[model samples]
Target: MPAVVVVGGQWGDEGKGRIVDLLARKARVVARYSAGNNAGHTIVNELGEFKLHLVPAGIFYPEKTCVIGNGVAIDPEVLLGEISQLASREIDTSKLAVSERAQVVMPWHRLIDRLDEERRGANAIGTTGKGIGPCFTDKVARRGIRIVDLMEPEDLLARMRSVVDYQNAVITGVYGEKPIDFDACFAQYQEYGQRLRPFVQDTQALITEALRSGEHVLLEGAQGSLLDLDHGTYEYVTSSVPSSTAGGATLGVGIGPTDVQRAIGVFKSYCTRVGNGPLPTELFGEIGDRLRDHGKEFGRGEYGTTTGRPRRIGW
Candidate 1:
């Protein structure tokens, strides 16, 4: 009858996935409320190991509905690959749904991300270059393509044409890089559109109706409070605020704050941070190495599930 939220108490890589997976047993729905492919949640059971980037941990339960809420930025390529990977293992993803209002990650977003990082040079913020920041930028700029637009070819093309021209100009005229081939992007996206159409829907309504029916829900969060764009480490934070509090949880899922019945914060014995950031207490050199080797954790060791980089350790 209420939704529960799982948030990271530290700088992420905190085991929120396993907690959500365990909680999904009682939840009728599990929804991912923010971020994009840049976030990863791994789950291990009798079905072997899985590193999920976009899909919710609840997908392991066939009876539970998994929703990617409106606050997320989706890379169709990554989502499709995950869907295929799950299918290969005889896992059913038919219960997964994407919000019609969710933003789409375009080819140019990745290209711009790399260029922007290069421009930062020595000051580079160590982004994953997965098109996350750029996609969200376009979303805020009102130039983003939504799931509803993606499933409709004619409208998608009309939008892509203008956005591509503008982005290519930024690449060539601003960054002095080659333009993204419009035709190739269109062709690939057209295929993606068809493949993803089945999962696109008015997810806000779906979530609302589920709540109305007195079903329990789980709102899964990505990143951590320390990586939140508005509140985390400046210039090195994620595009979204992944905290489970007020604006953090409900704003993304299109729900009211009162809908959340609990907020579960996941923490570890030590602090771990991925990407570039100021870790004042971080161990370096041999000391860092020894602690890292000691980390044969959760089928992923102590490395980041998203970046595969050895997580910086601190206590």
Candidate 2:
């Protein structure tokens, strides 16, 4: 059982990406078990720069295979768009495989996400407004569309129409917004389905086979342990699990409590967090601004990949 699990110990923005990228050199596989594009992993090496959202950080090394696990809620359009960018940079993403069980993030997820923020008003959770929370909500409700659903045209359309009708009612009647157009939305999803079909797979089997071969597999977790839904700051945590313990469970690796290995946590020289959450160690003086400025923390520079919002820097 040569498995290495990399997880965040702090409130996120930890250097988990760099650690996973470093470990990817020796590992046969690198898997992202949870979280969406909200978290951004910045890997800076001689091979230019890479900020991975949905894709695993190990993509830079062609030798390592990357898996996107079922626990993740995927946005196919965003993922394909990002993959194209990687291709433009000459990165070989052919080794990437996504789980058929992964949930699809529809356009309404984004709309509902923003509406939820607006509803929060002054009590906002500082969301990226990327539809992550809403996506998770749909997933838990058992009403979400999965990657495999993309394969069947009639089924996909039927599901899409039903969901759009349901969502449009909420948008118009409850949220006082315009109704969502099923035809347009269905067409867009159809294109996404066509493009994403090739990457969808049974990642569990692929990863299990690799583990059985005595190969080293590293589980890269997005977000931080402190931001976990169950353990993180109340009402301010991400929808997914971010701890090492959860990483194993989410990845389906079954890494036990006594796996008898090393546990490493990464943190920056400073502290920073994005969105509305309880930050016990946040700095509010010139030092905070200095750290933010020195880090070039503004705009979409190092913004949350999942949220697309600029992160708050601290020291």
Candidate 3:
């Protein structure tokens, strides 16, 4: 009951990452609760500017324990690459932990994501093609491969093959795309398992231990409250709730809603949304241009870290 949640007050890109990075100084544990690589957190610190997708922004603080919680769908390649990048900069990432219960974003998931989005055509959801939705779909459908599945060779192979077979059928039959090669996918993940095993653990227990010991915990939310699957714009929202207002952080991290003692909503001077959605207050033309210019959305800028598309800014 001593957790603090930092959530996006708008349609994401509300500077939640910077807030979490600053607040993490007072927290012993910082945990990401929802979304995946589809969501982005661009943190500019003394070391450098790091655009975080999966790893918690709290990783900057060597003293804090950062966790990829159960609510997160992990893309191993992205996460591993991010870790390598950080390590290259002399950043200490040994304190990070990946939840055993977190969903895995497999190769098929990424493939199907792009294929399906292309099929949508005019109705495309403007996805980052990072497979966040598909990975969560498998999680809800009970066909997900968890982090623990990667630990044991037999379990990993069996689970990966089962899901791959079904997904491969959809990929070829429905999307008319090439099916994911099971052997190749399996081999790649086998290497990923070896590299990721050290960070995999019972993150729920770790968080509980930190809480029970009276250590301050920070729960970081991704996307935004208005993009919540159940609460936001239908068909336009994210696949999961990434806000503490809807108890997403608790559910994502395997904790109770009551455990969060405070929730800080981060907001910008203006509203901005990245993906497809009905943004009524959305601005365009000169005002929008100036907003983008001031926010540095132009050039090699920080408009949409996940999609690299210009954000729809408004009042």
Candidate 4:
């Protein structure tokens, strides 16, 4: 197939990482369509176990091109950090490409995310506080900073000055928190932009050309269908569409619907959920505990890759 999309059929953590890792060896291009560092995948291979957040799982294959699509919210710090970590492990990240249109996760986004969750208290959405939601919010609001914006320091400064002012108001006035400093944040993110400049590009065009040449492309979705913003449980879902059929996978990568030749759904033997939400089929009491023990579902043992929280298990 020229294009294949791999999505989680259940709630998040449906073992899509392993599936993607296995398929990536044959794929010429492995592209991540949605979400951000809030989602993670753990891949175990001969190179070792790798917990990937911003980068794609296909990074294990040195020759395959890995892309982070425009549909994703990227934290430059996280992306660079992941690249650095991979480099430290002797993994070649030269083939990595980031979408110039991808929204950049600012430091204030993380702060507001944590504060928002804190304000919710008992009703918190169990977010990873990595600024995924806030970043997407800015994207939709048309006030977001993109990877391309980072290359223009003056424009970045101007945009940040305006956005940070409003963000500060909400942070201090509404949330009763300390305001984020514009200058300090600009300086910090400016460095991140410079570091990330090389990898930013028109990823949509790259994927389109790759597909035209009959290069096998795999689009990876993070989280799961149950966590998808539209199809998932209200108020508890992640901020993005996590289904292959949702068109987010292909659309985010700047490809047409017809470009994908196949869609693969990855699921586990049973259902599992992280954070908080409704799990009608959830197993509790003794059986649940036994299942948890057997499956090693507890955090520390086998916690969530992003939040490290013990997953709620179901039959």
Candidate 5:
């Protein structure tokens, strides 16, 4: 049983997607253990170029099982859109599975993320504004709505009403923004649930069974070690842990440490940090510009896969 985990060694954009995509050919199951649409994986193969947000990059392989683990916070709209986009490209997405225990990213979460970033102003953490941070916040605060909850209309409606009440208060009182419409939100998410229900399952059991059957499983992570909440630069890091050695992958996949046979850390020839953060080795001036241009690190190029913003490259 070969259970491998591929994690980013430096700040994200370390070609983990490409590595995972290549390695996925040997894997029976390839699962994304954490993060959400806030993290993007751009893959180019015989099928052309694709920028995957929520779904695992392994979906390209019709024979492999691709999973979104419970550690992820899923935005149903983004997920469905990605599925449709893949379908348009003639990729079979029927093998994709989502963890029912995963938390949901509501429309209000996106609003709150934007408002929060705006409030932070110059000191903003440079979030992707995809509601990832807020969704994790709700998860930690014990007020999150999971994929399973969405399957139950009445339960989901009741929980959404209470959550919206609290979220509206914060939006209005703290952020000074208008309250989200409960009815519209419920109806929209209700439909999302219907669309997503077919994909939901107990992913822990799924992966466990795969491991027990001596199948090769790959656990993929987003972001990077330097962006880990606990170990990275304070206030300028991602909210989740992106370290495979730190048990993030195991936790995401609901497995024990012994289950993982090895952890492969991916790094570029040089270092790069996306968004805002302390880049001790960041190159500036003409050299940086030349490097950026040579690497196509700006505008619809390599760096454009996720944010399009120029990556702060270094040694």
Candidate 6:
């Protein structure tokens, strides 16, 4: 079966969530390939309104399985919370799986993340204070903790302690902030690890098997293409590839240029951007306020799933 990748054509929040929910009916599996809880897809249907962060948007479909791919950065606590919310709605999340290879977002990451944003001061990128950027940083720096690492409580504790000590030194000494309690942070993640253990999976194996069986898949991105780190608008971009290229690379599909028979990009009629970037067409003042009021696009109430900041609304 063919694989379809849906992504935002501009910055974050371009109605990609609605499309994902619509396509979920035909896909056997809907996979989230990258980013973290920093970006989100809000879906409104007859069932009700939903804001999906960690898990795939296809969780709404009872027949479809949602896979969180390795390229993603996860906060187990956040994922569990999302699962609980879904269950409350009588949604079956039994098919949801977390890639063992995905990196785990810990307490220290959140602390440093906020501190980093604070340091930016007036030049703030408007992060959601969710530790996503820091988690990605740890991954690139080769000092990240993966879901597999959480399997060994001893290793998990040791690693957290080591990272915490280093981070606390920088935070207190360099950033001039109070030190974070190593024990408290460690205990919190331990609980998350315990709760999320059941969902950890070998995503590569599972995805390969699904493909071999000829099941249709949908690879979804949290943000848009222009926010892609490599191809987006310079330093203002998000940390991953929010395009078809990213889908193929991270998911191990190895899909090439010609392999893409059809591709559709989604964007809203209005324009919106979050964090630091060049929003050439941003509307503010009374005009922007009008859009927020009339269109109901305002406040931190509607934050990005991966970035965690309230979306900047424009028209």
Candidate with best TM-score: 1
Per-residue lDDT tens digits for candidate 3, residues 109-222, read: 888888888889899988889998888888888999988998888998888767777888888889888888788888888888889999999999999888889999999888
Candidate 6 minimal-lDDT segment of 10 residues: 252-261
Task: After superposing candidate 3 on the true structure, give the runs of residues whose Cα lies further than 4 Å from its correct spot.
Answer: 241-246, 297-302
Alpha-carbon TM-score of each model against the true structure? 0.97, 0.91, 0.96, 0.96, 0.96, 0.88
What are the per-model numbers of colliding residue pairs? 0, 4, 0, 0, 0, 12
Task: Give the distance in Å from residue 93's predicted Cα in candidate 1 to where it truly belongs.
Answer: 1.0
lDDT of 2 by residue, 1-315 (tens): 556677787777767877887888988888887878767777787877777788988888899998888877788877998799899988999999888888888888889889988998999887666677888888888789988888778879888866777888888887899887788888888888888878878887887777778887777777787777877786788875323344344343333444314545677777678888777777887777666656642223435645556567655
lDDT of each: 0.86, 0.76, 0.86, 0.85, 0.86, 0.75
Over 4 Å off, model 1: 241-246
| Runs off by more than 4 Å, candidate 6 | 241-262, 296-315
What is the TM-score (0 to 1) of candidate 6?
Answer: 0.88
Q: For residues 259-284, what per-residue lDDT tens digits would candidate 1 score against the true structure?
A: 88888888888888987888888998
Model 4 C-alpha lDDT per residue in residues 28-72, reported as the tens digit of each score: 999999999998988888887788898999998889999999888
Winner by lDDT: 1
Predicted structure 1: lDDT: 0.86
* Residue 61 lDDT (model 6): 81
Q: Residue 133 error for model 3, in Å? A: 0.5
List candidate 2 segments past 4 Å from native. 241-263, 295-310, 313-315
Tell me model 4's lDDT, rounded to 2 decimals: 0.85
RMSD of 1: 1.4
Global lDDT for candidate 5? 0.86
